[model samples]
Target: MSCPRTKPAWSSLLGNSRLTTIPIICFGHLSIMVQVGDEIPSISLCEENPSDYVDLKKELAEGNGLIIGVPAAFSPTCSDTHIPDYISSPSLSSAGKVFVVSVNDAFVMRAWGKSLDKEKKSGIRFLGDATGAFTKALSVDFDATSALGNVRSKRYAIKTVNGKVSGVFIEPDNTGLDVSAAQKILA
Candidate 1:
C-alpha cells in the first residue's frame, strides 16, 4: 500500500541552489533584492545645487521620486550612455523628482552633473552617496573588486511613492541596463 502524493510545496528561493520550505519575498525567478511596498531607508545624500546635504526620506516624502543607482560617477557606460538617457528624456519632467546616485564624492558628482546637464535643464538631481550608506541600505551595493575596485552600487532604479517603494528594477548582473533603463521606468 502506497500513500497518496501531496501537493508540491513552494519554498523561498535564496541565492543558493539549495531550497527550503521557508517562505520569503521573491522577484521573478530570483530571490528578492528590493521589492514593492518596502519603505525607502532614511539616508543623507550630498546634492550639487546649493552644495548641501539632503535627507532622502524627507525629499521622497514630498512626492513620487525616481532613484537611479550607478556604480560610479564618470565611468564610461554611466557618463556616455546610462545617465544621459534620463537627462535627455522628455518624460523626465513628469517623472517627479529624479536623482542620479553614485558612490563618489560630491565634487566628482558636481563635475559630472555639469558635464551632462550643462544648463541644469533636466532638473534631475545628481547626488553623492560617497559613504555607500544609502546604497547599502537599499541592499543593492555589490563588490566589484576586479574591475572597479572596492564595494559599489548595482545599476538599478527605484520608483517611490511618498517614501515607500512602489516598483524596483535591478540588474541581475549588477552592471547591465536591460531592466533599469529610464525608458523602461517611464513606461
Candidate 2:
C-alpha cells in the first residue's frame, strides 16, 4: 500500500488555528553587488554553433551586448519574471545583441527559450552556464549552498561596449525588475 502524507508539524503546533506567520527576519536581497562602469570580464558562452562554444573575447568585440545573468533556468522567478521581460521588451534595442545566461546546461537553456517563445527566435539567445566559470569571474556568484547546489549567479544585466560595462540593472529583490525591462536604459 502507498503511504499517506502526514500533516506538517509546524501547522499542527498552531492548535488547529490557521495563524499567519509574521516576518521575523528581514531577508538579504543584495543588489548586483557588482557595480556598473566596471570593466566586463571576458568569458566563453556556448552558442548553438557547431563548435559547441564561442570565445567571449572575440564575440564581445566592436559592439554593445546585453548580458543577462539568471540564478537558474526554469526556476519560478526566472521563468515567470526575468527572461520573459527581456524577450517581450521592445526597448532592449542595442547596437549589438542580447543573450540570456544561466548555470544550467545547453539543453535546459534551449528548452527554456522554447517555452519562453519558440516563435520569436533570434531575439534572445540562450547561453549555457554549464560550468559557471564565467559567472564566478564576474563576481556575481553567490553561495546558494543550502538549496541550489554549489555557487550560483545572482540576477543582473549589463550593457557592455567593447567588453566594458556601460550600464547595469541588478534586482534588489530577486523577484522583480529584470534588466531588459529597464525602459530608461533602452530609451
The model with the greatest TM-score is 1
**Total clashes, candidate 2?**
0
Model 2 ranges off by over 4 Å? 1-38, 48-51, 173-187
Estimate TM-scores for all models.
0.79, 0.70
Candidate 1 off by > 4 Å: 1-32, 49-51
Q: Candidate 1, residues 30-136: lDDT per residue as tens digits?
A: 22467899888788889764359978788888688999999988998898888998888878877798899988888889999999999999988899988888888
Candidate 1, TM-score vs. the true structure? 0.79
Give lDDT tens digits, candidate 2, residues 1-187.
1233444546556774755343344355443444666666566777653247855556666588888888888898788866776666676666367778887778888788888978855477888877887777776677776878877777887778887777867665543554545454466
Please report, in order, the local distance difference test score of every candidate based on alpha carbons. 0.83, 0.69
Per-residue error for 142 in candidate 1, Å, reads: 0.4
